[model samples]
Target: MAVCKGCGVTLQSTDPNAIGYTPKEGSEYCQRCFRLMHYDDLTVSMRTGIDPDQIIEQIAKMDALIIYVVDLFDFEAGMIPGLARKLPDKDILMVCAKRDILPDTLNHEKVARFVFARLKELNIKVKGLVLTSKLHSEGIDDVKEAIRMLGHGRPVVVMGRANSGKSTLLNNLFGQNILTSSRFPGTTLEMNQIVVDGITYIDTPGIEIENSLLMDVNESDLKTILPYKTIKPQIFQLHGDQSFAVAGLARLDLMECDHAACVWYLSDKLQVHRSKVQAADELWRKHYGELFSPVPLEENFRVSTIRKNLSKMDIVIDGLGWASVSGQISTISVRAPKSVNVTFRKAML
Candidate 1:
């Protein structure tokens, strides 16, 4: 059976709606990949149906070296909890992708330290770590060198969360766009193998982030939420009770604080509206989609109250950007999609 060169699905000319469908039998790429490559169109949502546990099980049975990719910007969401325990005995190399998105002034050493510290906390062990950016063509050589040294003549498996840049990283290493990659989550539906410089690399389906805002929003809204360029932190000084509406997708309200500095690191396209905390509810109820869009399809929201005693810390909205806070102790209320994950951590900046 002929398989699609792009997404590794069995090719079929009979069905237009099914995956791996092509108008012709001998086409190199399926119609889905063709549209995504040339027209930037997405025909399928790989978020559902694919089983992540089965994917991990298949990986565990393979003897290939594992190359775990994680998005640097959405680090917490990209992490596979209990990954080390699941893939025991396999030599894994962690690739922190999208290093270009972070502010350039930030120290790389500090970033590395942060990554290692987080890894230790998560109990995920790796043979090595490499930071990569497709925009600057960074860390490709380091990845190649590490693979050569640690691969032990086995096929290399590339795995990570959806939209984590696994396929893009592979294309960067290969010096060509041989696989289908997109800003849309779940581009790769199956395991696709490619050989470059005598090294066999297998691209697997991206593990879905169950509680991510990315999963909840429409594709068009993703353009504004996912940062394509380096972020310029938006700094806000809060004196009293204040609320910020992040494009109607999420809300952050400072209920009590003496004085605090809140810095937002997100896509420049997103519009953040500032208002008095007393008026926030009325504003949200009155003009959610009109004034504070693009909103999620469902209006159901979950409010989380966070008491921050740490002088400097980050409030991370999974799959969305984080807000770093400093100064006096504060009480914050985050209103976001009920399914989305919101938590606090040590400041990334």
Candidate 2:
């Protein structure tokens, strides 16, 4: 039976609105899996189609080492902790995918450190980490070399967040189309395995969901979220403690800095406005639906009041981009969907 490319469920052409509905070609999944793939609720997102528990079960069955790919742009959001905790025995080589999209000014050390720290938080032990740009073929060979060094005759289980280039990486390694891919998220729904150079490459769908940055956005907004070309970093120089919001879905509090602290490296298409940390709420209310437009009024999340202060935190507005704040003995309240991550970093600009 062919699996649905959208939800990784077994396909059935019987029901048009059901999961895996593929007409005569037949869907690749059941009805439930399909709704979860395109739905708005968190419960839908936590379903088996993209759940870490399901992925962990599959990971446990693999005999070879594991290669966990992550999006450099949305690393925090794509992280899967439970999967790592479940696969205690498998050796993991974390691959930081999509290097071409990040701003050139991104601090490499900070980025690497963040990835390592985030992986550790997920309880994933790694032999090494490779920063890669699948579009540029930057570290694909290194990934291959790492697989070779593992010396596991079994297949290499390739894992990562949704649309993190897991399929494309395999396509490059095997020089064949073993797994289908798209520019949008939730593209690869099933677990695809391809053997290359005596190595089995396991492809799994993206697990984590930071839908706050994705949902409610149309095709035009998608361009702002996942840019194909190198994004021009938008830097904002702040005098002291200040706050910023992207499309009303995310907020940032730049804590105290002795120097003129600069918050740089976000999506060029994203609109960033700077003001007093306290005025952030007012600015958002005034400009969210008008100036800094991201989501539609009716479709946006019902976030009436922002949450309390989040101190020393790094908030990445999925797709649009992320910000690393420095120079502060302060905090700011925020609110959004539970799927998005509010983290802290030591400044990677």
Candidate 3:
């Protein structure tokens, strides 16, 4: 079967609306890829991600060296829960992608430390961690060398959550857009195999995140939420009960706090609005999608309350970013779309 040169999907001329369709004979690229690459048009709704069970089952059965890609920005969403339990004895290499989106101030040592800490908490056991950036071609050679060293003449499997730059990283390493990659999630459908530098690399489908904030919000507002460039950390010293909204997608209401530090590490594309806790509900109910722009397009949201008893902790809103807070706030209440993947973990960074 002939596959598209851009994305490794089987080419066909029967259905124009279907995936990997090409009207012209002997076309190297699919119509979907052509439109995206040239006209910047997205003809597919990738919000509904692929099921992860098939991908996980297949990966668990492989004897290949696994390269697990992760997002530096939304680390929690990129993580596959119960992954360590599934593949306890596999040789795995963690690829932390989108390194260019982080500030230049972050050095290798600091990043490594953060990754290690997160991995430990997640219970993911990896042989090594490789940081990569498909945008700037940073750390590409190091990844290639690591693959060569750890692969040990076995097939290499590259995998990660949707939009984690798994396919983009491989494309950068080979200097070819051999796999489909986009800012939108759920691009790759099945597995695609290739040989480069005498190593067989399998590009598998991206695993779905069950409760991602990105999955619940409007598609048009995604560009604003997902950072295209480096992020500037917004740090605010606490005074009293304050409420902050991250776009219209998430509302962080600080129920109680005094002399505490609340630091937000998210995309600079998003704006943070602060108000008194008393006025939070009124403003949100009356001024949704106005002062709080990018409100949920259709999904139903729920109110979740978490008490920050830990001395230091990070509140993670899946698929968006996380906020680190010092234990000054007695309680933090979040109003977000249902299945938005909110979690509390020990402070990272």
Best by lDDT: 1
List, residue by residue over 136-184, the lDDT tens digit for candidate 2. Answer: 5888788878878984676788877776777777777776654555555
What are the lDDT figures for the candidates, one per model?
A: 0.89, 0.63, 0.82
Residue 230 lDDT (model 2): 72
**TM-score on alpha carbons, each prediction:** 0.98, 0.76, 0.94
Query: Which regions of candidate 2 fall more than 4 Å away from where they truly are?
Result: 2-49, 105-110, 176-178, 196-198, 210-212, 215-220, 253-258, 277-279, 296-313, 317-320, 333-339
Per-residue alpha-carbon lDDT of model 3 for 1-349, expressed as tens digits? 6887656678999998788899998988788878767775677665574678888889999999999999888888888889998887999999999987777798988889988987888888998988888767988888888887898899989898988888898888888877777777777666888898787888887888768877776677778888878888899888789898887778888867888888888888888888889988887788778867877765477888878878988888897887888857889888778878888887766
Ranking by lDDT: 1, 3, 2
lDDT of prediction 3: 0.82
TM-score of 3: 0.94
Q: Per-residue CA lDDT of candidate 1, range 1-349, in tens?
A: 7888888888999989999899987899999999999998888767664778878989999999999999999999988888888999989999999999999998788889999999999889899999999986799999999998999899999998988999999999999989998998888888889888888999999898888999899887888899998999999998788899998899999866567888999999998888889999999989899988989867899999878868898999998899888877468889999999997899988
**C-alpha lDDT of residue 232 in model 3:** 85
Quality of model 1 by C-alpha lDDT: 0.89
TM-score of 1: 0.98
